[model samples]
Target: MPAESQRLYERIAQKLANDISRGQYKIGQRLPSERELAQTFSVSRPTVREAIIALELDRLVEVRVGSGVYVTNTEPPGGKAGATDIGPFELLEARRSIEGEACALAATRIDDAQLAELNALLTEMRTENEKDVMLSEDADRRFHETIAAATQNSGMIAAVKMLWDARTRSPQSRSLSAKVRATGVKPRIDEHTAILKALRQRDPEGARAAMREHLTRVIDALLKATEVQELERARQQIAEQRKRYAASQ
Candidate 1:
């Protein structure tokens, strides 16, 4: 694929793969910390994280959580690299742009029944979230799709569904989501409530802003969940050094 056409994470993955193949990162060696890689590539840490996941999928590296990523194989298995999957951050950005408009349109056309359904779903989301149930995500998906259906625009519905499908089906996105969820991040019920309140008020701009803000927070959560805490690692190392000094004394 052309460099311009590829996702930022994909481009980073290709460069890192090349570096590995060229012996710059030897087998079993730990790659640079995520912060260092982000700095070197001039990309965000989440983008670097997606690249690392891509490398893992290709069997070129393995992620050792709370430690670092390590090179496993210089060459991809069967001489074939993994398919370029959509990055999680890229997917969320697309949703923020497209779904914001979808929410605005829905605000004008949504009926009382649709609003009621959204309210019920909101309750469901809260219940499932309190139990830490994965079903909360199902309710979350339906909440957005119901808004699209309210738009009464088939194209809008399809577009929204396509984005949700990508989130469900893309390997890279799924991997990142799994990591994020493992950190106890759940859907934001308050944001969803804000969206529904705007829709009920028939305020298109309010609905748009609320939807955009919700997705923006989701993106922020993903960034934080995937962050490799270099400072924490530094503290651990310091503690180890202090123990060694005490033992010697």
Candidate 2:
């Protein structure tokens, strides 16, 4: 595409994203089709494609193949994609990005009481049975919340709460809670303990390292699961294609 065309579409995409963020496009609603977009924007279909790609990257919309683009959850929208509808994956990613820093901040700001609360939560988690998912998950959730609280940043705490609340409400959040229970079976009882100790000592580097190690496990598992799901989808598509070919014969 020409440079001018690319720039034009990028501009349109940004405008649409701003609108979506402002609730111009209702959540779970479909946006105009590619042809409509091309006509409306006075650009080619390819330009519309580029625009959609940009919107997708912004998490303002999700392109459901063979259907159309749909508004994704932002603020004031419903929860996740599943029945439980906890929230959007983007929010989780955002929280991870910010809260990890919060942990480092908390390390610097932490006091005796905050350290005690964190330790209390960790202790509760250690005694939690594998089958007691709700309690165990709640404990884990509280630990992060406490960490956020320790940072003394209300905005950061609020943002993290929104993401975590959304996540807990999602049906697929089971994937997370279950993963926590399963992968955590070895009992990293000392994981939060290590972080709290570091925080108490005002070791920002140590706190950040601990947060990185903890969140890395989550990122790694989710990536693997996404890959597996993609492979399965591909296999199903191939099987369907083969069946249609045999019927045509």
Candidate 3:
């Protein structure tokens, strides 16, 4: 297999490791089924299996035939963090690099029909947002997948999928996303519209710029979300101390 393809599976394994450490899958707990994980990460069953194997090697999880994978009651191998563990900002940076290029390519190759499909998906997302409904990331995934398909490059499509998988599977990424959502940060409909407009005009550079800017906004949001979480935690701590002091009084 090519180096790039091999690296994709490694990213999957690291994502699992991150999830395990962050307590998404606790010790001795059954991890999500392979099919479920594949669907969640937008990867294939074989790729998911490879990641499970990596986890087993690290003693982070154990796979039992006729049952399923289970988290091990032990730390990751050598008590070291998973090699694939990455910060949320790092994940966004990877997306910015790969998806930006994919967006640029899509600009030149995307057909009118594909463009229409993307617009419909974005409209669906906007409607969901307007209703204050919890917007599903499925539509968001499809929008990016459509762009990758328009690029007409199998490798590019796979790379984009791998990056997205890392985001959904990584504990750090998921925790940051939860914070952002709790803070009521929804998808930026207008930002996506700008990206679509760039593609509609077949402006590669513009498409690239729009995609990069979108991911940059995500990075900024993640940073702000982390700060908000920390501030809230500090407030809780202070409140607890105040209660204790009043009790002494």
Candidate 4:
């Protein structure tokens, strides 16, 4: 894909790769901190994280937890990082929009059988979360798929399925998801329960809001999960300074 058409993270990845190839970041050397990279690229920390994951996928870098990203190779073995896959945050935003509408439609169209299925899936999700939080993703996927099916629209079902497939197939997205899961962030049963309640009540707007809220929280969770520990503490200190300034004023 052309640089102009590429996602922000992909573009950043390409730039970083070029720098690496030029020996700006020699093999075995630690790259700048995530905070520094974000400022240098004028992008968010999460976008920088996505770029780092792309580099990792291309075998150009390695991420060490609680340390920093390191240059593993001067050039990507595949010649370039995976640029075609959607970014994790981008996918979540798309889901928030598409699935919110699908849930709204399902509110009116869902039957008792589908509702029963969704309820069962909710139970499964809760149980899996209790057993091992990471294990709930499968049931979570089914829960959304079931909601899409309840819409009774083939197009909606396909669209939802495509999004889920993208989540699985995108190397960058999958890496980021794995990172998030490693941080102990699992599917929120209460959020799913709220959606089910709205659906059972046959409330379209309520369902839409519930779904959107759920996905919005998911986005927030991803951002938090990917944050570097030092950067998080820095952010907390900044917040405290701002509070103090406000009190002084």
The numbered model that scores best in TM-score is 1
For residues 1-249, write the lDDT of model 1, one tens digit per residue: 999999899999999999999999999998988888999999988789889889988999988766778899999986989888888888999999999999999999999999999999999999999886478999999999999999999999999999999999998887887887899999998999999999999999999999999999999998878775554667788999999999999
TM-scores for every predicted model: 0.89, 0.52, 0.59, 0.85
lDDT per residue for candidate 4 within 94-186, as digits (tens), equals 999999999999999999999999999999988898787656999999999999999999999999999999998888887887788788898
What would the per-residue lDDT of candidate 2 be over residues 1-249, giving only the tens digit for each residue?
Answer: 344644565667766766777888898988877777778888766456546655654566776644678898553233221121322334355666777788999988888988888888887887784456567667888988988888899988998798787776544444434544543443356667777777888998888888767766555554333221123456688999999999999
Off by over 4 Å in 3: 1-84, 131-134, 228-249
- What overall lDDT, based on C-alpha atoms, would model 4 receive against the true structure? 0.89
Go through the candidates in order and give each one's C-alpha lDDT: 0.92, 0.67, 0.77, 0.89
Put down candidate 3 lDDT per residue, 1-249, tens digits, no spaces.
344754555778777877888888889898877777889889866456556655765678876544568898456768764445444565677889999999999999999999999999998888877665345466888889999999999999999888888877876566556656777787888889999999999999999999999989977765554441113345688999999999999
Query: How big is the positional error of residue 105 in model 2, measured in Å on the Cα after superposition?
Result: 1.3
Give the CA lDDT, 0 to 100, for residue 231 in model 2. 35
Considering lDDT, which of the candidate structures 2 and 3 is the better prediction for this target?
Answer: 3
Q: Residue 22 error for model 4, in Å? A: 1.0
Q: C-alpha displacement of 171 in model 2, angstroms?
A: 4.0
**Which sequence of candidate numbers ranks them by TM-score, best first?**
1, 4, 3, 2
